[model samples]
Target: MNTPAHLLMGAAVFGRPAQTKILLAAFFGAVLPDLSLYVMAGTSLLILGISPQRVFNELYFSDAWQTVFAIDNSFILWGILCLVAIWWRRPWAVALTGAALLHLCLDFPLHHDDGRPHFWPMSNWVFESPVSYWDSAQGANWVAPIELVMALACGVVLLVRRVPIWAVPLTLVLMAAEIWIVRQWLFFFTNS
Candidate 1:
């Protein structure tokens, strides 16, 4: 998934919020998985920034990215964040973890090359199908199915919780918009 998809997932989980720190924590938690890639591409940069490649690599092992951040790490991190948030962020932890977990769940359909880490530490497994972008469909991978799910799930929960009924319609619209956005981003609008 791309950054927009991540933002969409995070937004769906934690909508326009009334809280700040919780929002930051959740936002960071949701993005933590991608940070692994930065670590990978960035081991060198960090070596430059911090001036120590061996120490940086030793502090955060390369395989850790392959295992922890590669697959389901965001969900796991969100779980820990949720528990930790309770001590600091209270009920907001619910929203925070929701966004973070949703980030991973959203990545499910778009996982590139079937190289998804669903079980994380349990297995460096990758799930791919012709239906998914991971199989490298004809430029169809840009569409973020997770956004649709997130919007739908958020709508359902909002309805059940009696959140503003207006949210349902709005979310449905968002889903459609997301599909088009993904298609455009993956194929048309983006520089291929």
Candidate 2:
């Protein structure tokens, strides 16, 4: 799933009492895994003065970079965070970690050969599903529409729950925009 979809799901699951901090934590949790890409891209841009597209090309094709950043999306990190939450008895941390885990769970069945190293640190294993969230050739063309509907449904739930009036619309717009951007990026990456 894309970041906005993950954020919407996190909000639907954890956004309650309309507390800003809690919602923010949930958003961050959903976004944390993808931060590895941001960090790698940002550093490459700064140090190498490369265009964003070039940086993306390198990251997408580089096995070494994938291995290095894979830890960010690993179940090992989730487990460690859960253990920390348990040890500290921090409900907020637990909620954040749970949101991240939800992100991982949603991603698990949607990735093909380029699946995440979900069991990293303990083992280098990736459960390559036949369907991919972004790859149309891998059956994501059908799945994409379903995900959009699910995200819209989640937005409705947020609205019904009386979340900030702008939240639902903003989430929907961001999801749509992200979907467009990612598809374009994928097209360029694949055809270039």
Q: Which whole-number lDDT from 0 to 100 does residue 168 have in model 1?
A: 49
Per-residue alpha-carbon lDDT of model 2 for 129-157, expressed as tens digits? Answer: 99887777787767776887676677667
Query: How would you encode candidate 1's per-residue C-alpha lDDT over 1-192 as one tens digit per residue?
Result: 654446445754675452455445445655666676666557655555544555345534456545645554544545666678666756556666667677777666565453446565555666664444322353444344544455446544434543344444544565566566656655553434
Which stretches of candidate 1 lie above 4 Å from their native place? 43-64, 68-77, 80-89, 133-192
In order of appearance, the predictions have TM-scores of 0.54, 0.80
Candidate 1 local lDDT, residue 26: 49
Please report, as a residue range, the 10-residue window in candidate 2 with the lowest summed lDDT. Answer: 183-192
Cα-based lDDT for every prediction: 0.54, 0.75
